[model samples]
Target: MQIEMKNIHKRFGANNVLTGVDFELLPGEVHALMGENGAGKSTLMNILTGLHQHDEGVIKINGEERSFSSPKQAEEGGIAFIHQELNIWPDMTVLENLFIGRERRNAFGLLKTKEMKELAREQFEKLSVLIPLEKEAGLCSVGQQQMIEIAKALMTNAEVIIMDEPTAALTEREISTLFEVIRSLSKQGVSIVYISHRMEEIFTICDRITVMRDGKTVDTKRIKETNFNEVVRKMVGRELEDRFPARNPSPGETVLEVRDFTRKGAFENISFSVKEGEIVGISGLMGAGRTEVMRAIFGLDSIDRGELYIHDQKTVIHTPNEAVRKGIGFITEDRKDEGLILDFSIRENIALPSVKSFAPKGLIDEKNEQQFVDMLIKRLTIKTESAETSAKNLSGGNQQKVVLAKWIGIGPKVLILDEPTRGVDVGAKREIYSLMNELTDRGMAIIMVSSELPEVLGMSDRILVFHEGKISGELTKEEATQEKIMTFAAGGQ
Candidate 1:
């Protein structure tokens, strides 16, 4: 299979998202599409998938010019898109979710359940996924659900598979399994268009790389010929001195303490403490209970056995509202579903956490809210047309900044961030790390849950390793190495 897009041009009202962009993919190759946020990567992909029409462009597959009117047309033509956001039917079983809208039926309209199950099992085996076929998709963890999305793409018999940040929600082991699956598929003559902000993954798995800037193609290079620094330079059009900002630790009294927290089968006896002016990182594999523990601390989950102390005072937090009132903020891992409302405007979303302040007398002070949002937009460097722009209209990085702005407005004493930088670009990741430093400098305690070992090591003053719903070990800034953390994360004694 050979796919070529030439001189692609697309515009949304006054925004020219893609202008004179060119892209190509060959058979049996993993082509990486690299760019900073809002560099028109998603816009170009949307044009190819028929979700949006390009003002001017040409698409050719296998030497035949093609114009798809809908996503179904593109799918039927052997193109499948695995979106960055999980798009599975949560209530349906894995098998049913995979075969939705494309189920095989007999002449009498009876579904071929057994045949579909067998096919699903085969794909799962190929991907090394161990999830139960009959299990509800929502019951699975984020990493497991990512595997299901991949399997669903494979079920389409797609020759050209487009994976948009497929590993964003996966752990190290699940990522390895996905890379193996990609290699196997490539060897079978399946061309893959991989889009990711993670530079290491691109270097490890992709054969060729295309860098886009603004609304145009910057350069394309063979992975072996180009290095990470050069690729990043092209993507952001500048030199990045360091991925993580310099950390200055000035510890204060403990602000939040969890003693022997337990959540039945999810996690047990998880104990930790976060001090003022400290950035504590939680490191672990997927399903290792990092997120579960944080949820319990943030009052999103019930704690069966434990004690929570805030400012040296025992406190009872039975709900998120209570947590918020007790000076706690939680930025969930799945930002699309939990962090922000998609249909809401940027100003509205930013004001959500502190709505009471804007409406003290039962009526919203529109002027005050707009001024606050404008300040956040400028301070966070959020790129948007105006405060009224929909959260769904902004780039992934900008949307993350909005989530941060909302929390910052609340002035929480303890902030819990789950996968804080997932799916964001390199520039934005640096900005977020800097923001963490600033927050901690102001005596705000932060507990970060990250699967990226480098991030944990770079930004954390202390690290807590989790394995199989337990605290395996703890390390200080000077003591925590990637190998040491991994050893503990793998359930080492």
Candidate 2:
């Protein structure tokens, strides 16, 4: 399959998304789409896949001009799109979710359950997935869910597959397996359109790359012909200084501590302490209990047996409200579902935690609220027209910033961040790191749970590795390295 998009123009009211963009894909080649969060990468792909119509453009497939009316039409034309957000039905079984819309049936219209199982098993075996067909889809971990989405796309036997942020939720081992699968598919004459913000993966797996910046195609070059710095410079339209900011630690007394924390089947014997003016990083593979521990600490889940201490005093928190009142702020991993209300304005989401502070006498104070929200917006460098803009209207990086701003408004002594930089662009990531440094300088302790090793090493004062629900190893900032952390994470001494 060969696809060519030329002189594409898209507009939504007054906002122009894609302007005069050109992209091409050849059979049996992996093409990369690189850009910042709102650079129109996804928008261009959406136009190609028929999710949105381009106001002006020409689409040609195999030298024949074509325009698809819907995603189903595009799929029927041998194109499949695996979105960044997994579209899984939680209540349905794994098999059911996989073959939801395109189920096989007999001549009498009877469901072919046996045939579907065999087909699904074939795809799962090819990908080295061990999920049960009868298991509920919601029971799967995020990494497992990612694998499920990949397998679903492969089952379609698509000639051209568009994968957006496919590795964002996967672990190192899972990513290796996925790369192997992609290589095999390419060898079988399948073309792939890979979209990701991770420069390493883009250079490693893609044969050719297309860079987009601010609704325009900046350049397209062979992967071997370009370097990381050049690619980033093209994406952001400027020279980026550093991937991470400098951290100068000034440790104070312990602000939060947990002893013998045990959650059966989740994590066990988790003992750690975070001090004021410090950053403690938790590193582990997916499903290794990194996120479970944080959830329990924030009172979102139950702990069978544990002890929590705040400022050298025994504390008991049974709910999130109590945890907030106790001076602990939590930034959840799923920002769309748990962190913010999508339909609400940015001001509403930012002011949610500290609403009572502005309304002391059971009446709202609009002036004080506006000033407070406006300050954080400017401080975080969130790119929005105004605080009145809906959170869903902003890009992924800006939404993550709003989540951070919401937590900062509460003024918690200890803030817990889970995957703070996941799916964020390089430029926004540096800004978030700078903000983290500023917070620590102001005597706020942070406990960050991250899957990315470089981030853990770059921002942490101390590191703790988790393996099978236990603290496998602990290392100081000077002692930590990628090899040592991976060894601990893999349960080696």
Candidate 3:
């Protein structure tokens, strides 16, 4: 399969997202689409997949000029899209999701569950994907769900697969497996459109790279001919000397502390402290209770036994509001789901945390609210048309900035960030890191829970490794290494 998109142009009102962008995908090759957030990667892919109609473009598939009216049309044309967010019905079993809308039936119209399960198993085996066909899709791990999505695409006999950030939520082991699957598929003459912000993956797996910036296709090069710095320069239109900002100031007195925190079946004996002007990173494996401990501290989950102290004073927090009032803010992992209301305007979401401040005597001060949101937008460098724009309309990085703005508006003394840079572009990641540095310089304490080891090591003043619901070890900035962190995360002494 070969896909050629030439001179693609798309516009949303006055914002032209894709301006004459050209792309090509060759059979038996993994072609990477590289760009920063809102650089028109999604828009171009959406146009290719028929989710959005391009204002002007020429699409050729297999040497035939094609126009697709809907996603089903694109699928029927042998193009399948596996979005970053897996499109799986949580209540449905793997077998059911695999054969949806194309279920096999007997002459009496009875569903052929046995046949479907058998076929699903074959697909999984071919990809070396280990997942139970009987298990509910929602209950599966993120890595498993990603594999199921691929299996489902295989069921469609797709010749071209478009994967958007497929490895974002996967473990290193799972990522290795996925790369193997991609190689196998390429060997079988399948074309892949691999999109991601992780530069390492692009260099490791992609055969060719297309860089887009400001809605234009900058250049496409063979993977071997390009280096990381060149690709990043093309994507962001600037040279970023460092991926993380340097933290220089010494940490102040302890601002937040947890003593012997225990959550039955989730985490136990978790003890850590964050000093004013310090970044204390929590590192661990997926089920190692890093997130659970933070949730407990934020009062989002009940703690079976523990003690929390704010500014060295014992505190009791029964809910998120209580925690917030006590100067604690939590920026959750999934910004779209838990952090922000997508339908709400940026102004509304930013003002949600500080509603009381903007509203005196049960009435909103429109003037003050607008001023606050505008200041955050400018301060955070959020890219949006206006404060009236819906939160969902912003790019991934901008939406994250909005979440940060919300918490910042609350004037919290202690901020807990979970996967702060997850799914954000490298440029935005640097900006967020710089913002963290600025906040810490101003005497704010940040506790970051991150799966990215490089981020943990680069930005943290100290790291606390978690293993099996307990604190495995702690390392200072001068001592922390990826090997040591992994050792502690795996429960090694």
Candidate 4:
């Protein structure tokens, strides 16, 4: 399949999403769509997939002008899109999700369960995925869900697959397997449109690259002809100084501590502490109990046995409300589900945690709330039309900033951040790191749980590695390296 989209222009209520964008995909080639958040990468793809109609454009597939009316039509035409957000029916079984809309049937219109299972198994086997067909989709881990989505796409036998942020929730091993599958698919004459903010993966797996800036196609070049710095410069339309900001540590007394924290079958004996003006990074592979530990600390999950201390005083927090009252803020890893209310305005989400402070006499104060929300939005450099915009309308990086803003509004002494910059762009990532530095400088302790090793190494004053529900090793910033962190994360001595 060959796809050529020329001079695509799309607008939604005065928001010009895609402007004169040109994107092309060749058969058996992996093409990367690189951009900062809201750069119209997804918008252009949506137009191509028939999710949204372009106001002005010419779409040609295999030298024939074509326009799909729906995603189903696009898929039937040998094009499949695996969205950034997994579209899984939690209540349904794995097999049901795989063949939801396009189930096979017999001549009598009877369901072909056996045939569907066999087909799903074949696709999963090809991709090295080991998930049970009868298992509930919601019970699967994020990585498993991602694999399920990939397998579902493959089952369509799509000639052109658009994968957006496919590895955001996957582990290193899972990513390796996914890359292998992508390579195999490419070898089989399948073209892939890979959309991701991870520069390493883009350069590693993609054959060609198309850079977009502010809803415009900046450039398209062969992957071999372009470098990381050049791609980033094109995406952000400026010369980025550093991937991470410089850190200068100034230690203080302990602010929060967890002693012998244990959650059966999750994590155990997790003893750690964060001092005033310190950033403690927890590094581990997926399902290594890093998120579980943080959830327990924030009272989102219960611990079978543990001790939590605030300012050297033993504290018992049975719920999130109690944790918040104790001056602890938590920014969950799954921001869409846990951090913000998607339907609510940005002002509402940002002011939710601190609403009581603004309302002194049991009455809501709109003016103060708006001012507070506006300040954080500006301080965090959140790009939005206004505070009235819905949380779901913003881009991924902006949504992340909103999550951070929500937590920051609470004025907590200790903050817990899990996968803070999972799907964020390079420019926003640096801004988040700078914000972290500023927070620590103001005597706010932070506990960051991250899977990205460079981020852990760059921002952490101390790093703790988790393996098999235990703290395998701890290292200072001066001594920590990628190899050492991986070794400890893999349960090394």
TM-score of each: 0.98, 0.98, 0.96, 0.98
Q: Count clashes in each candidate, considering only residues at least 3 apart in sequence or on different chains.
A: 0, 0, 0, 0
Q: Could you give me the TM-score of model 3 versus the true structure?
A: 0.96
lDDT against true structure, model 4: 0.93
The lDDT of model 3 is 0.89
For residues 1-493, could you state the per-residue lDDT of candidate 1 as single tens digits? 8989999999899988998999999999999998988899988888888889899989988989987888899999888999888888899998888999999899999999999989998988888889898999999888888889899999899999999999988888889989998999999999999999998899999999999999899998899999988988898889998888999889899999999999888899888899999999999898889998888887888988999999999998888999999999999998888999999999999999899999989999999998988998888889888898999999887888899999988999999999899988998899899989999999999999998889999999999999999999999999999999999999996
Tens digits of per-residue lDDT, candidate 2, 427-454, equal 8888889999999999999999998899
Cα lDDT for residue 332, candidate 2: 88
RMSD values, in order shown: 1.0, 1.2, 1.7, 1.1
Measured with C-alpha atoms, the lDDT of residue 65 in candidate 4 is 96
Which pairs clash inside model 2? none
Q: Stretches of candidate 3 above 4 Å error?
A: 125-136, 140-144
Model 4 lDDT-worst window of ten: 122-131
lDDT, candidate 3, 208-299, per-residue tens: 99999989999999999999899888888999998887789678999998999998899988887899999999998877888888888888
In model 4, where do residues sit more than 4 Å from their true spots? none
Alpha carbon lDDT at 343, candidate 3: 99
- Give the worst 10-residue stretch by lDDT in candidate 1: 294-303
